[model samples]
Target: MRSIITISREFGSGGREIGKKLADDLGIPFYDKELLEMASKESGICQELFVKNDESYTNSFLFSLVMGNYPVSADGRINPDMPLNHKIFLAQFETIKNIAKKGPCVIVGRCADYVLKNEPNIIDFFISGNTAEKKKRILERYDIEKNKAEDFIRKTDKRRASYYNYYTDMKWGEAKNYDLCINSSKTGVDGAIKLMKAYIEIKEANADK
Candidate 1:
């Protein structure tokens, strides 16, 4: 089952849960927060920096890129003066590529679909759902107050969209950007999973043939 699956999702769309279940069922690794952990360890950059920049744009890109490589490269070893945000992004880019090299796995968010865009064995998906359904899911799942659910979903989705657009050439959540776009509100999680499983199985079978 040589495939790398990346899920791009709306804030409350159940995309992460779907990715986790897919990895488990496929007996593969699921990466979401794990990517940050690896990046921090390998790059010597603080984990908080990566978390702070995750799925969001940084104003310091050009200036930081001008700085060299790492903002705090005191050892005369690092890039000497890289933008903090760019350093974080570079670390993640390398980590994403390294992870893909390890084998077939499921990756969630972090613009992973864009990171692995060149791989032929990749399957990309974008998960979205109706506003009502998403708000309910966020409220229940995060225990967010009922009154705050609407704003929560809107703001989060906006951030994700901005992040993706800033880092990649494509528009976020656009149907043309993904191989499959599932509205989890109608199909539900299990049904959507079933659809993807069938899709991949067919692809694998065709490849074998």
Candidate 2:
């Protein structure tokens, strides 16, 4: 199997579950919010700051300038002029690379796939779902109402897309940017997992030739 699996997913698409299940099934480590803690520790940034900027773009003009004015890294390598968002991204990017180097892992979100795009053993996947299904799932899991869930999904997806597009050369949720794009609403979580397992197995087996 591939040494690294990165899953990019819509907010309510059950992508984290898939990644966790895949990692469990394959006996590899799974990472999601755990990455935030790593970046926090490794970068000397507070855990709360990482959580605040996690997968989010800096939108305030003045705020951006202020954060940019004091840019620095944990080890003092990054340029001081860099923005806070960029610093956090660099921290996560570095952390992702380090994790992948340790061996196979299933990482959900945080643009791990894009961060490791040059690596040969990495496989990337994007998971989306039907609007209704996404809304339903969101409503059930969160305190959001039916109407709010729709708006929440749209806003969250947009933020994720913007964050991704800002960091990577490719567009978010685009099929060409990933090895596979699956509609979990149709395939369901287990079915999607099955498909990914088969696909990864085939790809890895061929690599052995």
Candidate 3:
């Protein structure tokens, strides 16, 4: 049914874990860092470079040129004159679209919600938590002292927001931007997934009617 789930998450909200579990439960492919690899392979760029520059803003023309926006030769290599970042952005954009076209899959981060905003079967969710809960999660996962967790969360979420804001017109973590704005601290990770599944099913049933 062309189900594409896009999850936008706060730092340490366990959204990635939820996405993986959801995909496993639904028996569908899950995409996260793997998307970067696929995009790199498809665009003929170095995988490490792709991951480094992936979703990263580029003001440099050279960076944009290597990314492949220029016309390709008969052999599919980008023309010599194009900016790398532009090329990479276009390639990644196309890759994301292609993945979505394949049907139901879970995509985490990378402004995927905005990418698939127009798709009828797409369900966009934003997972967030109270500051204390988020900090605790980060501290435990990274094995950091509690005092450092707040700063880490702030910096991480700021980077995510910057990345998302640069690529899309929508604001990151805005409730209105998503179909479901879940507070993971309240629902917990598994509960959030269950709620998301139920929400999707209800929406689909209503659409069918």
Candidate 4:
């Protein structure tokens, strides 16, 4: 009930839905796309840039070499010359920390688990589903052909994995990296949320003792 929850989810896995509902039921704030807006405002960067780079990282080594690392000078100010992608990430990193300071909330994706790794009251979850279930979910939510849904899901998950793996030392979807790994296909969204709530309650109670 008093933990900052971070959810890393596979494409079409109902992760965002679970995070929002969990926050609502717990009377805490939920952040997903809303984090992008806050990042834009905080960094004075265009919102479009954050959306474009959100949850996906650049894979080209040459491009990264040209852009250089996300740098902070001795004064602790981010270098003006840092790449746009890095800038967006830094913005999100700062925004996530700022949001956590406000209180317990559910944050979805964006390597939030890594960003807040050192912060207290952190609980991370990874949500995944079987390929068939994910494809069905994608087909229903998006106006795409049934034949293309599987490919779409595969590509989207690849991008997310690349993003997360690039940002954090831990592998995405790895069971050990998360406090709990839920297969939404088996339990469904409501069941997954219930499980998370139960886990958080137990964790909080143990902490108090």
* Top candidate by TM-score: 4
Per-residue CA lDDT of model 1 for 1-209, tens digit only, reads: 89999999998999999999999999999999899999999999999999988888875342233334334555655464666777788888778889999999999998888878888888899999999999888887887789999999999999988878876778999999888999999999999999989988888888888
TM-score per candidate, chains pooled: 0.89, 0.88, 0.86, 0.92
Could you tell me the TM-score of candidate 3? 0.86
lDDT tens digits by residue: candidate 4, 147-169: 99999999999999888887667
Location of the lowest summed lDDT over 10 successive residues in candidate 2? 60-69
Q: For candidate 2, give the lDDT of residue 58.
A: 66
22, model 4: CA deviation in Å? 0.7
The digit string of per-residue lDDT tens for model 3 on 71-173 reads: 6778887566667666677677778889998889999988788777779999999999999888888877898878888998888888888777776667898
Off by over 4 Å in 4: 59-70
Which model, 1 or 4, shows the larger TM-score? 4
lDDT of 4 at 21: 94
C-alpha displacement of 104 in model 4, angstroms?
A: 0.2
Candidate 2 lDDT tens digits, 1-209: 55699999998999998889989999999999999999889998788988998888664322232234434468866676776666776677678879999999999997788777878999999999999988988988999767688899999999999877775567999999998999999999999999999889988988899
- The better candidate by TM-score, 3 or 4, is 4
Clashes of each: 7, 0, 17, 0
